[model samples]
Target: MFTRRGFVKLLGGGFFGAMALGGYAFGVEPLARLSVARYVLTPSRWPSGLKLRIVALADIHACEPWMSTRRITSICERANALGGDVTVLLGDYAAGMNLVTRYVHSNEWSKALATLKAPLGVHAIMGNHDWWEDRTAQKNGGGETFGHRALAEAGIEVYSNRAVRLEKDGSGFWLAGLEDQLALLPGRKWKRASMGGLDDLDGTLAQVTDEAPVILLAHEPDIFPKVPPRVALTLSGHTHGGQVRFAGHSPVVPSRFGDRYAYGHIVEYDRNLIVSGGLGCSIAPIRFGVPPEIVVVDIG
Candidate 1:
């Protein structure tokens, strides 16, 4: 059943198909396409007359080769143009994941992000990459600081297992950033370890009562199930909108919950969760149906 001509044709056809698919993934898919995923959520405890517009930026892995300073600046400009009462950045601001080629310093990118302006202001939280910096702090020293330092320089408050009351015109809600639990898992070897994991979910929620509308900033959506009922909303990244999807279905997702919490808005236990399709690429720099986007949520 095998012939020399038949085998050659089969091989040639397979090669062409592979090239075409790879070309699309590497060339056409990575272009920055912005879209606004809007959601209207009214928390039972939301203060009357207090309208909050929330913008979430996640997984902006501003690596040197992939994400340059000028590009990061442009990203901030686009985010600012959208206009939100408060802007939040979910972590992984480092240059790259898995292997590093050209490293993008956090401070420089944070300065670019500082340009993002809003009346309520901008906030951020650390991802696993930030925690990796802490793991290598002894060798890298201050240079390893990723998430908090840069954002702080840009007048953005970095939330780590803490709660802050953001007030606007005498009305506001409690916005909190939970620590990266994955980064701090104990007994984890080789670049993935934490001295003391301080997620402190209970302590973080202690400041907010049952009657307060709480918006949570978490890098991973795995925390969704653990979140108490007080938190009306959870904004997260690190999913990268699955980065690759076929027919709106992603075969591989970096979540313990699988497709249950992969991307987009998920309403579970009466809590609304929004996971963004981030600005930059990670692991392997290829994306399919899932394009990079900025999410704007309006809630009153």
Candidate 2:
């Protein structure tokens, strides 16, 4: 029922809309937008008097133009201003993708991250990219990766299948960090069998001698199903909110559960999990709908 002129106009409009969307996704959102995704929660077991403000930064994926040392420093400065009792670095410090003008060296990015300050101190964990990119670690098959050493050298405490007890205002809690769920790369030189991971949830949780509310720092949210109720909260980042979210849905999540744990606060059966959209891109240098975020969690 449409005329030839109307058909041509519709085609032209669609073309321009597509161009605009592409420009925003590739040029603007990824490079310019920064947001603070804040969440305040009180888990059932968390002590009422013990309030903790946790400032968390995830998936640095350090690279030039997209995520430089200067940019990381700026992000840290903003995080410090938030005045958190503790700060946790949810991994992926290595360059997530090959698309980069210049890859930001590990030392450089770690030095920049050293500026971040919190009362309880800064804690970090390894992400899949951190393990996959470390050729020496991959080749060695077992040992401290360059990312771990870099973070340690920077004075940040890097935990892998480790748990530490922290006290705030005479109240204590456990901060447990797990090794990456995708620690081993199968296609690489060292091929034992299938894709195995270094993550040890049982071992990590076993170290929690006391019943203080445990806050688990895991790089990927895929391990959420196995997490027991002993953990009051689990923090993760690795999906990058699919790196192109729309209408609260991510078309392609790196997680086995798809959009279930892609981003934001999720609770199932009284178990709480918060997956940050994170500060860098992965696989591709583009972001839309879900902007880079510095997650602030105030919980008790």
Query: Using TM-score as the measure, which candidate wins?
Result: 2
Worst 10 residues of 1 by lDDT: 137-146
Question: Which residue segments of model 2 deviate by more than 4 Å?
Answer: 188-190
lDDT computed for candidate 2:
0.94
Lowest lDDT 10-mer window, candidate 2? 187-196
For residues 32-109, write the lDDT of model 1, one tens digit per residue: 455667778786667888888988888878775556778788878888888798999998887446444566777788
Estimated TM-score per prediction?
0.86, 0.98
Query: How many Å off is the CA of 103 in candidate 2?
Result: 0.2
Model 1: residues with Cα > 4 Å off, grouped in runs: 1-14, 98-101, 137-144, 185-197
Candidate 1: give the clashing pairs: 63-95
> Candidate 2, residue 22: CA error in Å?
0.5
Please, what is the whole-model Cα lDDT of each candidate in the order they appear?
0.77, 0.94
Position 218, candidate 1: lDDT:
90
State in Å the error of residue 163, model 2. Answer: 0.3
Candidate 2 residue-wise lDDT, 116-227, digit = tens: 9999999999999999998888887768898999999999999999999999999999999999989888866676576668999999999999889999999999999999
